[model samples]
Target chain A: MQLDVVVGFFLLGMVAQLLKAPIKMPKGLYESLTLFLLIAIGLKGGVALNSHASGDLLIQAAAIIGFGLVLPLIAFPILYKMGGLSRIDSASVAAHYGSVSVATFAVAMTVVEANGIEYEPYFPLFVALLEVPAIAVGLWLARDRNQELDLKKAAHEIFLNQGVLLLVGGLLIGWWAGARTDSLMPFFSSLFHGVLALFLLEMGRIASSQLGVLRNFGSFIASFGVLMPLVGAGLGALLAHALELSTGGVILLATLGSSASYIAVPAAMVVALPKANQSLSITASLAITFPFNVLVGIPLYSVLVGHWS
Target chain B: MKKRAFAFEMAVSFVLMALGLVLVQLGLPGYGLVVVAAILMGLSFVTRKWVAQTANVKVAAPKRGNH
Candidate 1:
């Protein structure tokens, strides 16, 4: 599997940033690319969902929700007690790990495709499903400090979030359109890599910029960024084994479990955990965990899936 | 001035949606791209509204402080 094309662009972005090169994507363009990727992914999944049995879909959805809910609970104690982070910081970081990274999931999908591994078509639905519950769990864990946690507001934020909305909407549209969605392949499928390359370049730039901030958080947080993913993957592997997921499905699950939310969860955290350190969560997710997952974790998880399945 | 900015933002969004429609009409393989284009368009409007709301808060803050 040639991962170089995607990884290379990522490296290019990071290198350019490190060199302080003036390369920059227009903010709107970057956001548009993200919109494209999320909708495309969701639509693809929805189209696939049309042919899949309802029972299997329900089972998978339940399993994924369970998987998502557990991740933050697993991370919080470790962060709060072991890492000695403050309550807000631990919960914030835990929430990040609990939710999924669309970018890392994209990379994992690319790898699976490159390797010609068969995966669940509704995996995108899993992506959408997994985004919410961990956030709910994370917020719940931080409930002590955040006395005024509004369930209504949090629900509105999580469910109505742009990323979630686009993904779910695309899924519904794709399911409704069925084979008629074939016409969309040229725009959504053909140009996927090119758009992904552009998106990743921007990510590399952002991640590199965040690197300077990592030093302030200390070795524990830095190590937690790497360590939490491994732990997530281990648990994911066990779940995949028990669920009897395919190699591709296992990889996807592991990736989902291992990857942290830089986009959705952080946005939620800003509103939900007002006192939480935004930089700590963002740095841990985007700067450390994201790069780690894309570059190393994906391949490692793939190997783990191979061993498990 | 705020109304004018909001209108301008909406116009840009409409144009983006139109562009997406054109991509679909051209018989692109991925009709889903239309949805992507539409999402971008919707996002433009949402962003504009968010910006407007934020600007309003910023403008109102000083007035409130003076009291």
Candidate 2:
């Protein structure tokens, strides 16, 4: 298959990650870069949807949401049993498989945008919604049957965690406050590309930093990371087509459904499912599968969307 | 299954997603989405770091006892 630019960026990011010490992006800048990417993608999607929003689109959103919830339910057990993780670890990992990664989805959106492909604007919103259920399910899985559940801790982790709140929160505020173009536009619009570029740069740094971990358990993690997303994409596409979504809706659904929640899921997992091996979850999401999805996954999904839709 | 907490998070996530959808419905343009997402994601990262630190400190406190 011919490699696309987004995939190239994904590779570049991975290369930067592998060479982290020499390519020094400050850790502090990482999140900021990711933020920029999401906002940029969101704005573009928002602009596109101005003419297109309808009842069918909402149905498609529901499909994406269903895909997000279902794919993890199917994939996590395989990952857990095959990867030799403890039950809690498996559940945490499984939870991540269930949630969508806003950053990766953002990157995919950037790719689709650069390619001039039309996709649903609500996809990111679906991505945000997708983050929660897997977490709830994962927590349920990880919770000790013998011990009384601590409602307070669960509440804090779910409600207060920055990732869950911010991406979803920002997207909602921007959507509801529609056409606040005079003042809010400049801040949201001008600064996003620079932020994403920087975020990718920092991602390079993070992937590289995680290299040591990869070499030790590279095979198992990489296999799962690559396979899981494909599993998600497959399920997403089937669901979209079954729902008779538009081509763009189908593509967006596939991407959202396939994408893993590296940021939101991992952060929440650290609190919600403490016994789970975070390093494994983080490495799988960020180091192994994330780059792979961006590079090969998006184009592959495009083709799948193209062929299936 | 803390009813209140679960409901709050689900509610918050639902609102965020809906907000994003509405933004796209309007003609505010692409950069607006990016900036908004960037700020939210950045804040999330900060909060994640804070939580991680607390989790680590809690983990380490008992280790100190062994020493």
DockQ values for all predictions? 0.01, 0.02
Worst ten-residue run, lDDT, model 1 chain B? B28-37
Going through the candidates in the order shown, the clash numbers are 10, 24
In terms of DockQ, the best-performing candidate is: 2
Angstrom error of the Cα, residue A253, model 1: value is: 0.9
Please give, for residues A1-309, the per-residue lDDT of candidate 1 as tens digits: 234479788989999999999896776998999999999899999899887748866887898899999999999987887666788888989989999999999999998988888888888988999899988998888888528787788788888888889989999998889899999989999999999999999999999999877546644465567667877877887787677778898888888889999888887888888889999999989987888777767875675466446
Candidate 2 lDDT over A216-266, as tens digits, reads 442445556655776677787778778866676676667777677777777
**Fnat values, candidates in order:** 0.00, 0.00
Q: Which residue segments of model 1 deviate by more than 4 Å?
A: B1-67
TM-score of 1: 0.80
TM-score of every candidate relative to the true structure = 0.80, 0.73
